[model samples]
Target chain A: MEENKKTCLHDKHVALGALMSPFGGFDMPIQYEGIIEEHNAVRNACGIFDVSHMGEVFISGPQADAYVNYIFTNDILSVEPGQCLYGMMLHEHGGTVDDLLVYKRNSNDYLLVINASNIDKDVAWIMKNAEGYDVVIDHRSDELGEIAVQGPLAEEIVQKVLGLSLSHLSFYTFGEFTIYGDKPAIISRTGYTGEDGFEIYTDHESTRRLWDELLAAGAKPCGLGCRDTLRFEVGLPLYGDELDDDITPVESGLSMFVKVDKPEFIGREAIIKQKEEGPKKKVVGLEILDRAIARHGAEVLDADDNVIGTVTTGYRGISVDKSIAMALIDARFAARDTQLKVRVRRKVFPAVVIAKKFYKKSYKK
Target chain B: MSKIYYAETHEYIRVEGNEGYVGITDYAQKALGNVVYVDMPEVGDEFEAGDDFGAIESVKAASDLICPASGEVVEVNDALVDNPRLINEDAMKNWIIKISISDEAELDDLMDLEAYEKYLESNPH
Candidate 1:
């Protein structure tokens, strides 16, 4: 395999004795102290993540809403001026182009946060989709960087560092603010970990300075390992794991976000068709009975030795002390009480399909 | 008191009479990060040299516990089911499994403390 590209924080991570690995085209830190400890830290205290590798694209124009709503699967028009919408851009054939968070700055301007690996493809896809529409799309993925401060106490660290109270911010809301008067950036109360946190979008050139600033302000720097466990515990859908081009949003149990009532979106017809005809499969969560973990490609088998599904993602689930996983399988097998077998290499571990929300949120809803 | 011997697979073995206490090395535990689960061997199982006796599942990956020396499983660490960190806290002191060694000569092939550290130098995570 080829050597992975390094992020701006590569030197900082190496100096901190972080274990580095290639993730989404960037050489990133996998862990610092450990995965579970950092996970628990984010749960109980606060942790800062170097999420600069995530792509940030800016789309501006008077017809931004019309263009956004036409291509995105969600009702992007519902997003308030200072709020962000977690949505998906769809391929014409109903597959997902990319799962994104479209932050509306105003009626005319919007920022689309997309996955790092999908940035180039997303830009090309978005451009191709907007060929006839009257809109200007900018793939500022290289010009911008992002970081997330997550957990229960993240609000305090943000306020302390930037001298601003995030108390006024609601979930999925954002505002452009200046940090120490160097450059203005977007700070949003949103995160992947299902915790009370914020994702800051700033200039790519100024990110390293701000990262050091946040750490100096007493935010514990966390790594990717903890991010996986934190997101897994809450049953958040991670791209390439819970989501991919091979799986439709409806099949991944994200049908709730797909508004069939919305007229003429890219994948609307397919989503409506699926709703009317019923999908072949549905995603379900599994809680293992033993110590064995269900990995991304592990087979979810039945008692009869037939493979029913494949485990999408899994983790230790530090708080629960057992393995928990999500799997997209035959819709007929999507029952809360249904038992399944996960083959972990040679051993077969017993598992059961459970309702979503592996860990309940205590957020200010 | 048992004398501790180390395996080339990074497992530690403590010899008490003909019985051998088995667990992973400290280096392996540190590399594994926070251990979430310890899959143990069945108490009645007998294993050959280099056979995977059990596994330790961390948050990222599930790793096998290769048998350093072959033996019948006399005991398995049930405490590690919940407290797998014991392997990290004290690897040699807290044995994961105890086995009756088939041959004492096979133990010589295993690396000792000084040689094991030397082996770790070539292979880095």
Candidate 2:
């Protein structure tokens, strides 16, 4: 078997006594102090995450504008330079290739940020589709390191610790600046956590320096364990859980991100058809009545004990303090207040269908 | 003082004559992190050695609690239903259940405190 890859901060995490685990082909930190403590830090105060494992691909050429719009589900033409749009890349059959953020640099330049687990497959898909377009595909997944500083106090912490002023950047917008003696860095007012934050992308050396400064400034160092809980609470979909190669954006309840109104794009017809006729299965939020957690792959059953669906992700919610889960079940049973049951281990617990957004998001905009 | 025996799976049985208090080891709780819930078998439930009695859930995942020996459950720790973090605070003090040993011979199969500590050193999680 091939050895797992390590991020630039692997040694730092180990030095802090982090519980290391394999995630998305990288040996990453699962927790520092504890998952619950780190989770609360992001929600209440400030937290820093080493997100260097995320992939970065640059597309440039005269045809970049049209090329990106054709490949991505969102309408990149609507956004101006220095702005970002969140959407998915879909197969012709409407299943998601990967959900990504497209940063519009200019008319002929754009940056695509993708999931770490789907780096190779996504780059290959992008390259294969570039055959007919006059665009340059620059796969730069290995050259950049990224970190996210998130929470309500992120703006102040970024300013005081990193010596960067983000007053000009709004939500989903980015700007280029020189840090550490003219080293170019990109700071974006974006984050997966449902809080006002910034994602900084820079070289490995600068990334390490920024991380140390933030930690010294009292920003909680978070790991993937809390990252999952934070994103799940806000209804943000993870790649392998809420979406995959076989799950369409519509089926995953992410229709808002898929611009089906666009005249030409891959999977447009399939998305339109699914919207018109409705999808066979829909992802819905569930609140398990009992204390037992309905983990991923647990069976969702009906009143008659008939199998209905499967849990995509679940947790004893740190913020909400409920046994909440997101499950993909038959569209017939997707209505709010619909009663369901989740079979966990030797016992079955009653559950009720709820809105996917278990906790109200606190976005700045 | 009662004798404590350890199973290979990390469960501990504190024996007092033929009755024993069963719970997970301190090492097991440390590995599991913040315990959110503990699934305990009801009184009078019978299990064979190596049978899965219940589960212990953390915020991230769930793990099964294996039976250390053949026994019938005499009592369950009801306090765990409302507050499961007791295990994290003190695993030895927060016994999950009280089981009446069906066969004392099964106790011989488990490891003593000294052997269990040695086993942990060799097989780290």
Using lDDT as the measure, which candidate wins? 2
Pull out the clashing pairs in model 1: none
Best candidate (score: DockQ): 2
Which parts of model 1 are misplaced by more than 4 Å?
B1-5, B16-19, B44-46, B103-105
Candidate with top TM-score is 2
DockQ of candidate 1 is 0.68
* CAPRI quality level assigned to candidate 2 from its DockQ score: high
How displaced is residue A337 in candidate 2, in Å?
0.3
**Residue A102: error of model 1 in Å?**
0.5
